[model samples]
Target: MTKSDPNRILRRLPLAVGGLGAVLLLINRLLTPELTESQARGDVVGVILSAVLILTGLIWQQVQPRSPDIVELIGEEGFVLAQDLPEAVKTELAWASHLLLTNTVTRSLIVYYQGKILLRRGILAAKAEVTPGPILKRVLETQKPIYLVALYVYPGRIEFDYLPENTQGVVCQPIGNQGVLILGANAPRSYTKQDEKWIAGIADKLAVTLQE
Candidate 1:
């Protein structure tokens, strides 16, 4: 069975029990009449149990946990590359960015080198400037990548004005000591471990190409 099968089963269990209880109640009436006080009390108890089960089933279905709906963000779709970049570097940037947008959960990306915004691709925000916030600074200083799962929960998200403001997740992959690869996803907790590793590989490649 699939992962959702368990939830489906749990969801149907109460209804099933209610249905069985209701059927048994009807069957009991045909089998025997509740003429005695004890028999009538037992009948009332069965009716109460059936009602509770049915009510619980209806409530559980409404409150069942489901996947979060990621709203489609409003943004411009394009890439802005700084002029004077070498043709080889530009090609490498384009190829890598394309791969990321197509293959991963990334909905937006920015490539920063030294103090310049070398590339801004995919769904871009209205702003054109990007100042390295504490998170970005930390990544560059320690040369360690940071994955911000569910970007909406982080205060540092305010610094990423260059990416779409409603971006659900982000990956800040440091490129050597002077550059960083910023990837924004369409959904929270969307990127897998393998995706992060592949992104690091691409960032390394960009570092080599940009420096050359």
Candidate 2:
């Protein structure tokens, strides 16, 4: 979509309202009341009509798609993680427990580290997948994040130790670049460009922490 000049719209709104007011005044005078008491109805109609025109003019001026702000979204999601996982992982099982709880995306999230699903968090109760190692390894190689919305992962979504039902959204980021940050939503295509940007920001933060 083409970008809009916000400054131009801001300038036009007042002019549009002034024009609407003039038109409403003309109508109120031209359509005189039959009875003196009915003049109240004209006043009411004028107010309602003026309100509708002003609203219509304002909406017509500011209808455009804007770019998603990624950094802001990252800041919001990162807060969720920092609050959930403040401590370092001691045991692999404990690490898995942390992953499941910290990750709000899927009903469960499995983290594959060092050729194993090191953590599992969420509702699914199944044995680790048969091919998690290869799947995660491939995801690690891609160096980009994957978003899964509405419980369905992409055609080649990395295999997890267990499949999660109602897995609305999935984001797979390579640990090397940034630990994968998956944010889930129930509706399909719920992940917008803004979400990707936010996830990327979170991944970048994780990368810095990992490097340090």
Candidate 3:
């Protein structure tokens, strides 16, 4: 159930309905002796043109690539509930970053437990220690997500100093007391409140899954 799946279905639905209606109209016009041959031909031509355009649009949409969100991945790539903790965490890190369309250089996930990094993924550099700095600390203390639209715009921010040089935006969400999930992107204002909500939901799921 990726985003494209619904889009593809919706795109074809209108075409199906419109084609049926056009067929019915063509049948009625064909039966009507009052319709001139030229008029009938015009109607057929219009229907054919419309159908071809609709089909072409559908094909174009099908060919376009779409990123999948968490919900879609959960349905299409199951076993989130069955996999062990480590596997599930890795799967989630990959899925969350992919769904958010984070830049590869900036995308990262750091799992912290008892004031130390337990796992790291997608980070650009290898540092001696990965601490939950001010931004992450805020997320953990508030038990809420934090989204920095443009890290560079905010001078002296801890994240701007620590994140990859190309990072422009970041989203941080606490995974219970177990860890925090961090997603960074190369474009300013890359994440919205809606994105924060989705990330928070994933963090919560990860926290619960780890506990189980």
Candidate 4:
């Protein structure tokens, strides 16, 4: 489920209230409350307003959900690679990075291998160096990927200052036990389940390539 799932459910609040009002109004009509002519007019007005509320709730439910607002990142399009990498490994990294940037929602990518920056491509930050903080370190030790579907809510995002600033989402995919593939997206919660699986497969392939 997405981070906004709960918020979306909360939108039903208006419908719930409207439903309750309808029920109460139905019962009132059945009981046939004694009232003057003016009171009956007011009652009619209340019923009309209740119907409007129900209609509004139905329209709200049908409305499409909008993507989360994320500030655009400040950076330049660039590519960087570790000079010590073998030609084969360099070629593999370049191919993977290019595919991810062009095919996926990824706007910035970084491959940190064996304690060094192996590749940096797509929109790049000013600083070339990367320091793994709690989040990246945890992912490496656990050997499990961490998907920050929405980064603005997480304070740990600060550690990825080397990535394009204000990156909306991040995925830390571990390569074997020594490397982490960081993918930064332009919009929050844009990556789907299929995208995650594809990224994991890419990481597995990179781990083997780097080892060779």
The segments of candidate 3 whose C-alpha lies over 4 angstroms from its true place after superposition are 1-106, 159-162
Clashes of each: 0, 11, 0, 0
Model 1: lowest-lDDT 10 consecutive positions: 1-10
lDDT of candidate 1 over 53-156, digit per residue (tens):
98988888877556545767669899889888988888999999999998888989999989899999999899988898999999989999999999999988
What do the candidate models score in CA lDDT, each in turn? 0.88, 0.49, 0.59, 0.87
| Every candidate's CA RMSD | 4.7, 10.3, 9.2, 7.0
Candidate 2, RMSD to the unseen true structure: 10.3
Q: Which ten residues in a row have the lowest lDDT in candidate 2?
A: 71-80
Compute each candidate's TM-score over C-alphas: 0.69, 0.46, 0.50, 0.69
Q: Pick the candidate with the highest lDDT.
A: 1
Model 2 alpha-carbon miss at residue 8, Å = 18
Off by over 4 Å in 4: 1-65, 68-71
lDDT head-to-head 2 vs 4, winner: 4
**Per-residue lDDT of model 3, residues 172-212, tens digit only:** 77889756776656566646566667777767776876576
Please provide, for model 4 over 1-212, each residue's C-alpha lDDT reduced to its tens digit, 9 standing for 90 to 100: 23456556666767777788878877877788576787678668778877887887887787766766656677998988889878998899999998888777898999998899999998899988999999999999999999999988998989999988889999999999999999999889988898999899999999999888
Selected candidate, larger TM-score, 1 vs 2:
1
